[model samples]
Target: MDTAGLEILGEEECLRLLADVPVGRIVYIDRALPAIQPVNFVVHGQSVVIRTAARSRLAIAATGTVVAFEVDEFNDNCVRHGWSVVAVGRAGQVTDDQELASVRQRGLRPWAPGTREYYLRVDIEIISGRRLRHADAPAGP
Candidate 1:
């Protein structure tokens, strides 16, 4: 079997990509308006963790919300294809002291400056991934 010029990553590879990336775009709705924001996140166990301010939009939008967490990587030369991992899940505040302690021990830090007082855990309901290549055509002309 010869695999060449083909880009197909296994589930483990996708998980590796997810674990390696620190920042992703989170998709949610605010008052029926679509929104996407770059967020700092960590993949813990089978879920995704995010730290935000107590009153920030992400913290508010994530409370009891079903959202999308997406991460991807690409190169300018395009010789190496990029992969995307999308996690669809419900977001909620992380209140368990033990869990919070464990998360803190993992060295997960907030991207924004100052004290990030809110922590959210997104229980992953569905996880899927796709690959992108320079050869792929744009959706529209």
Candidate 2:
């Protein structure tokens, strides 16, 4: 992709954008191969929390495993006009009763129909993003 119209976003801006989105893709290694799953999530402090089944691949991911969580928004009529944010971190299950209760209060629900009884939290170590603005778009204030 061309880099002329791309603007690198700072960590704070990236986190703010992430907070506005409800869905993101979680990338992890599964059986020696990289896999991606779309999940509904919420940003809790510096971590991204997602709900999944206990036996699901995501829930079973070993603690401290490095993973990538990405969220983006694009214009249908103009695909190039959009922004993407990625959070790289280690995956950890929310096993603490107090933490689980706090996360539950955020009402993080899955869009899929099924029993999602496990919560996985990704402790973000690095966050980066880029925005693609049209050539004719007005500059920021």
Candidate 3:
């Protein structure tokens, strides 16, 4: 047998869950259309940092705008609990080469091959999250 659904977890649990995962989804508005993409990120202080190719959508999305990031996980037994944290804030490219290089040094590699000529640093503003523990999640956090 198998079961699947979303459960809302507590705030502490949400942060803990966030630290356990390295990948998340970043949602942004593009020309009035909503776009979402999975990305590898590091939670730096209150912000999320991700590396991207020079001309990729991720890079384009980071041009002085706010974006959303979500990460969640489930158990193998199909009985699982997970949470999603959304960071709504302004996005920008990390201009300092030294800082960018340091992120590379931290072992955050890109899934896409070839030269990753750009990196994005998203400063979180509204940090709200929700956890999925059962079938019905209230109104979210």
TM-score for each of the candidates: 0.82, 0.90, 0.77
Instruction: Identify the leading candidate in terms of TM-score.
Output: 2
Q: What does the lDDT come to for candidate 1?
A: 0.78
Best by lDDT: 2
Give the least accurate 10-residue stretch of model 3, judged by summed lDDT.
1-10
Better of 1 and 3 by lDDT: 1
List per-prediction Cα lDDT, in the order shown. 0.78, 0.87, 0.72
Q: For residues 1-141, what per-residue lDDT tens digits would candidate 1 score against the true structure?
A: 114443555667667788888798888888889888898888888788888898988888668999988998765456355667888999889899999998888777888798896888888787767665545533211
Q: Rank the candidates by TM-score, best first.
A: 2, 1, 3
For model 2, residues 28-136, the per-residue Cα lDDT tens digits are 9987889899999999999999999888887776356999999998876777578999999999999999999999999987777799978999999999999988786
Q: Which tens-of-lDDT digit does each residue in 17-57 have in candidate 3?
A: 66668789888888778998898878776678888887887
Q: Which clashing pairs does model 3 show?
A: 7-131, 7-132, 7-133, 8-131, 8-132, 9-131
Give lDDT for model 2.
0.87
Which of the two candidates, 2 or 3, achieves a greater lDDT against the reference? 2
- How accurate locally is residue 81 in candidate 3, as Cα lDDT from 0 to 100? 48
